[model samples]
Target chain A: SQTIHQWPATLVQPVGSPLSLECTVEGTSNPNLYWYRQAAGRGLQLLFYSVGIGQISSEVPQNLSASRPQDRQFILSSKKLLLSDSGFYLCAYEGADTQYFGPGTRLTVL
Target chain B: AQSVTQPDIHITVSEGASLELRCNYSYGATPYLFWYVQSPGQGLQLLLKYFSGDTLVQGIKGFEAEFKRSQSSFNLRKPSVHWSDAAEYFCAVAPSSGSARQLTFGSGTQLTVLP
Candidate 1:
């Protein structure tokens, strides 16, 4: 069975600080990876997705970026965090049609 | 562009009562529909999905949704609501596009089940 894992279940960052969130999938290769953000009481917004290593497609232009370094390792990073950037971050792997989610990371910018 | 619309922003129901949440979509052609649930501070879980064949699809957690092509709507239904079912529900549409396999999500509806 395939499983997804994300680190830093909760994070507290200062404004203008750098941020990194990691996501890795086990038992699956060549799976499509995605990074999404959910605003407070809002829907899930797609930030980036990678179909293969070194190929990242950004859905929404923001302060964050994504990179797929390995077949199952994807990372979400930010050069400088903004106050509005604080939210729940989710990493997902796509099956044939359905997408599976990770536990998600909560970042609070103070 | 293809999009999803979940009309209800919030729904409140008593435990053991019937439940129905409306979801409508705007797309040009046949599109795939999905329902997901998100608990507080947790990731979004796929509750159900509709591709073809059966109009009504059953999913985990005793949830079922019916797809109506004419109305472009996929409404989720449950025979009886439970306290555990209280969470945020999202309706998403997946257009048959390239290798991305991306999903466009709705604003979501927050369900509050009264005990």
Candidate 2:
């Protein structure tokens, strides 16, 4: 079974601050990875997805960007965080037609 | 484009009672269907999925979902509900044979189990 690990389970940042969240997958190689954001009382929104190293696709244009430096490592970053960016961010890896999710990161922008 | 619809935004059921959550989907062909549960401030946990073969799929935590191709629905059901089952449930669908394996999720149904 593949395991996904996301760091900084909870984050608190000020408006206009830079942001970085990391996601790493184990027991899988060259897997499809995705980033989704869920706001309060809202559905999950696809932010970005990566097929392989150095390849990233943005689903919704925003202040956030994604990078896949390694086959199993994906990073979501933003130069300046917006108050609307505050939400629960999730990382997922596709395996055997199934996308498994990580614990997720909760971001609070003040 | 594939889409999922969970009609019930919120449902309240008594503990030990039977429960059912409705889900409908739209796609060009038979898509992969999935059910996931999320607790407050937590990530989604996969409950069950249906790719092919049997239309009825069993999942973790005593949950099961039956896929009806004729009706384009995949409804989750449990014979006996527990207080721990109180959480938000989401229905999702993905293309069966596409390079883009992204899932389209519904708005979600919040389940509340009364004591």
Candidate 3:
């Protein structure tokens, strides 16, 4: 019964403001974590993935960055948010043959 | 490089009608394929996956897909569509090597069921 949790289901941030979105996994350890963004009515775009603590691979280049502080904790952060950074962010955990997604965080940069 | 392509951006069908969504992938080897459905305000739900052996695989919500190696395609099919089936569908592929779990997703297809 592995479950992934993400906080701040919805957030409104001003441009140039700092951003932080957290994700944690329960019932699973040493799991791979991923961050994805989806625009309205569009497909998901992978942003970052962490295989272990302190190790992160970024798929796209942007103001956003991801960190794995603990075995089951991942954080997506940005020092200065931009208007283009607004989207629905989804955190996912890699399973044996499938991937499980968290509830997700919707950030609106105003 | 590995990639996935879902040609149809949107599809509409009547309830109880047969449905098919086309998916194509470009990979270096016999890739692992999967289909996912996303309902409004919900996370992606795994429908099915194909690794080897059988080309055809069954999934939840009465959905199925077939892998055609020669065509480099994996198309999703359903004998009868339901009203609840109206949602976004994504086709994905994973390389056999590397993480063996990293997936490349298609742009996704929006399925609209007409009652």
* Candidate 3 CAPRI-style tier: medium
For model 3, residues B1-115, the per-residue Cα lDDT tens digits are 8889999999999999999999999988988899999988777888999989989999998999999999999999999999999999999987765662777899999999999
Interface RMSD of 3: 1.9
DockQ class, candidate 2: medium
Across B1-115, the per-residue lDDT of candidate 1 in tens digits comes to 8889888999999999999999999998878889999988889999999989999999999999999999999999999999999999999988766787788899999999999
State the weakest 10-residue window (summed lDDT) of model 3 chain A.
A38-47
Clashes of each: 0, 0, 0
| Distance from true location, Cα of B80 in model 1, Å | 0.8
Q: What order do you get sorting by DockQ, best first?
A: 1, 2, 3
iRMS (Å) per candidate: 1.1, 1.0, 1.9
Badly placed stretches (over 4 Å) of model 3 are: A40-42
TM-score of each candidate structure, all chains considered together = 0.97, 0.97, 0.96
How many angstroms is residue A85 displaced in model 1 relative to the true structure, after the best TM-score fit?
0.7
lDDT by residue (tens digit), candidate 2, A17-94: 999999999998999999999998779988999988999999988989999999999999999999999999999999
Rank order (by lDDT, best first)? 2, 1, 3
| Cα distance off (Å), candidate 2, residue A85 | 0.4
Which one wins on lDDT?
A: 2
